[model samples]
Target: MTLYNNVFETVRMIEKEKLDIRTITMGISLMDCIDSSGDKSRQRIYDKITGYAQNLVKVGDQIEMEYGIPIINKRIAVTPISLIASASGEDNYLEFAKTLDKAAKEVGVNFIGGFSALVQKGFANGDRILIDSIPQALSETERVCSSVNIASTKAGINMDAVKLMGKIVKDTAYLTRDRDSLGCAKLVIFANAVDDNPFMAGAFHGVGEPEVVVNVGVSGPGVVKCAMEKVKGEPLHVVAENIKKTAFKITRAGQLIGNEVSNRLGVPFGILDLSLAPTPEIGDSVARILEEMGLEACGTHGTTAALAMLNDAVKKGGIMASSSVGGLSGAFIPVSEDEGMISAVQNGALTFDKLEAMTSVCSVGLDMIAVPGDTKESTISAIIADEAAIGVINNKTTAVRIIPVHGKDVGDTAEFGGLLGYMPIMALNKFSSEAFINRGGRIPAPIHSFKN
Candidate 1:
C-alpha cells in the first residue's frame, strides 16, 4: 500500500536522521473537585486527580514502547489554583497545592502544573492569595509548577498585576535564596495565556475544555535535521516545505494515538500540541536540527531566522492535520532538557545572548537553563527583566526558568539527571544593570500593546 511505503520511508528517515516524539501530556480539569467547605477542599482535590490519572503513566509507557518512539515526559495540567481557592483563603489554597504535589508523586507523575492565577483585568480574592503564595509554595514543593496571567487580548494589560509580580519575583529570590532561590523558575507571568497547554509553567485546564483529556506533544528534531541534511542547498521556502510535511506526519501519529487512548479511557479527547519538544536523547533535539541546518552551532547569528522558519512551518503543517491543535505549538529550546543544547553550551557553541535571541523567535524563553551560583540576584532579575521586555514588546509569551545551582559556578556541571538533563553553568555578561533595577517602578506597556 502507498501508506505502507510512506511508513517505510519514514522509518528509513528515522534510521538516517534522528527523529522522535518529545511528550504526550494529558490535560485534566479539576474544577469539579472544588468544595463548599474549606476543611474538605484538599481531600476532594487530591481524590479527583489521583482517580483520573491513576493509569496515565502506565498508558504513556505502554504507548511509547509499542511505537518504539521515546515519550520523554508524562505531565498533567489542571485548573488554576486561584479559581480552586475561590471563597477559600490562603491557607486552603496552599493546602490545595500540597494535594496536587502529593497526588503527582502517588500516581508516579513527574510534573503537575496549574497552580496559577488569571488577573488580566483585575484580581479576585482567590487570585490575589494564590499569586502571593507562589514563592512559598514553589520553594516548598518539588513537582509543583505555577503561572499567572497578567494580560490578554480580551482584557488590557494589567499594569498593577505586573508590578506586583515584579516585586514578588524579587521576594521569591530573597526567600528561597538558599536553593539558588530560583523560586521564580516555577512561576510565569503571562499575556494571552492559553488554557489546555500541555507545557509548563503555563499549562492549565480551561473552563471551556472537557473534564479529562489527553494532549500529545510530538517532536521530530531528528526528522527535521535529516530532511534538512538532504536538502542542503535548497531555497529556504523549499526546506520549510519539507519540514512542514514531516511535522504533519508526526502530528498525525500523535493525533491517532491520542484519540484512541481518550476513547479507551472514556474521556473527552483533547488537541495535539504539535510542539517540537526535545529531550536528552541523542537523536531527539531541536538544537540538533538547527545544527543540521548548517548553523554549525545553535547560538550563532542565523539561529533566530532558522528557528522562525521551523516554528512557522511546523504550525502550518500541524494545524492542517488536527483541527484542535493548541498549546505552545512551536520549537522548545529548554537547555537543560536537551542534550545537544547542553553540549553546545559546554563547548562554547551556545551563549546566554544567543539563547535570548532564540527565545524572541522560539516558543518559550530561557527555559530549564542553569546559571552560575555566583550570579547575583540582580543578575537573575535582569535576566527576567530581559525576557519580560521581549514578551512585553513583541507581545509573545516569553519567560525565564533559569535554575541557580547552589555552589556551582561557570563551567561547573550540575546534574538534574533523567529528562531534566545535566547543564554546565553558563557564564553571564559581567555588566552592571544594578542601578536600573534599583530604580525599577514599572516598564509601562508599549504604545502599540493594545491588540484587543
Candidate 2:
C-alpha cells in the first residue's frame, strides 16, 4: 500500500514538476585491458566497453517505459585512462580517446568518461601524457568527456597541474572554436573529485570500485521549487523542511530506478546521486528554486545561504531515502545549463565572483560558465586555484569547467544547442596571475584536514 502511494506521488511529480532520473551511468573497470602496445590496449578497451554497455540504453529505456519515468541520459564511466594506458607506453593518448568514443557511439550512450588523470599529489608515468592529450582528445571526439583532479583535501593542491590545465583549457577552446568552443565543455578540473559521480565531465570508475556497477543521478529542482511555492512567506526552517520532504520523494524514485536497472543488467547497484541538476528547459532550473525561497533573483546577497540550505536539505533527505547516497548529491548551478542562472547573469545580478562564492556552498564549482576569448591562461589558472582552495579548506568536492570561448566577449552569446544551452560570455578581472602560477608547487592541506 505504501509502495502504491509513493508511486502515485512520483507520477504526480513527473507529470507536473519535471522530476527525472538525470542519468543512468554504468561504471566499468578497464584495468585488465592494459597492454604494452597502444593499439592492442585500445582495442581491448573498446571491446570491454562495448561488451559491457551494449544493452545499457535499451535497458534504461525499458525501465523508463515500465515505470513511466524519464531517464534523461545513459552514460558510461570507465577506469581512468591514465591508469589503463600507462601499461601501453603511449606518449599520445588520442587513439585511446577515439576508442572510447567509438565504443560510446557503438553502445549509443550520450557520453563516455574516464579520459582522465588523477594528479592531486603529483604526476605519474601516464598522467602527463593524458593531461597533455586532453585538448586534442576532447576536440577530436564527440562523446568522450575528460577530467583531471589536481587538488584534494588529503593530498593538497598541485599548482603545476593547475597551471598546465589552464593552457590546456585555452587550447581546447581554440581547437573547438568552430563549435562555440564545445570541447572545453567536455572537460573539467576538480578538487576532491568523486569516483561514483554519474554526471558528465567528471565521472570515472575509481580504483577501489567494483568490476561493474550502476549509478543513477536524480534531479528535481522543479519539484522542490513547486513545493517551496506552496509555502510562500514562510520562515527559513519551514522552507528547508519542505525541500527535504520533496527531495525524499525524488530520491525514492531514483533508488527504485537504479535498483531495477542494476538487476536487469546483472550489475551491483551503486549510489544514487540526488543532485538538483537543472537543464535549460522551462521549470527545470536550480536558480528558480533559490528564487522561490524569496530571493528577488539568484546571485543576490542571500543566494549563497539559500543554496547552502538547499544543498544540505537535499543531502539529508536523500540519505534517509537511500543508505547508498554518494557522488555529488547536492544542487548544481551551471550558468548555461540553468535558464534562471543565465538570466541572472544577463540581468547583471550574477557575476563571476558571485558564482565563485555560490560554489562554496553548491555541489560543483564554476560549471558551464563562458569567459572572454582573450582571457589569459594565467587568469584561468587563478580561477581554478581559487575554487580548489575552497574545496581543500572546506573538505568538499569542487570543480571548474569554464570555457573561454574564442572570438567572443561579454554581451555575446556562445551557443551549444540542447542541454549544453547558451550563455553570454562573462567578464573577468583584468589582472595577471603569471607570477603566482609560475611558483609551481603544492598548496599544503589545511590544518583541519589533519583529522587523526
Report the Cα lDDT for residue 194, model 1. Answer: 77
Which stretches in model 1 have alpha-carbon errors above 4 Å?
10-21, 61-70, 119-123, 150-189, 432-452
Give the winner by TM-score: 2
**Residue 7, candidate 2: C-alpha displacement in angstroms:** 5.6
What does candidate 1 score in Cα RMSD to the true structure? 3.2
Question: How close to the true structure is residue 334 of candidate 2, measured as C-alpha lDDT?
Answer: 88
Model 2 lDDT per residue over 321-394, tens place:
98699999999988999999999998999999999999999998999999998999999999999999999998
Report the C-alpha lDDT of model 1 over 1-452, residue by residue, as the tens digit. 99999888767755555455555566777776677776577787788888988888887788767776656677788888788778554443667778889989998888888898888778888888888788778877878888887765445556567656655665665566675555656777676677777776667887777878877777777777777777887788888998998889878877876776676666777878888877788887888888777788878779899899999999998899986898888998999888789888988989989999998888778788777666665666667667766766776776667676666778678776666677888888899766656664545567786656
Error of 2 at 405 (Å): 0.2
Local distance difference test, per candidate? 0.76, 0.94
Task: Give each model a TM-score.
Answer: 0.87, 0.98
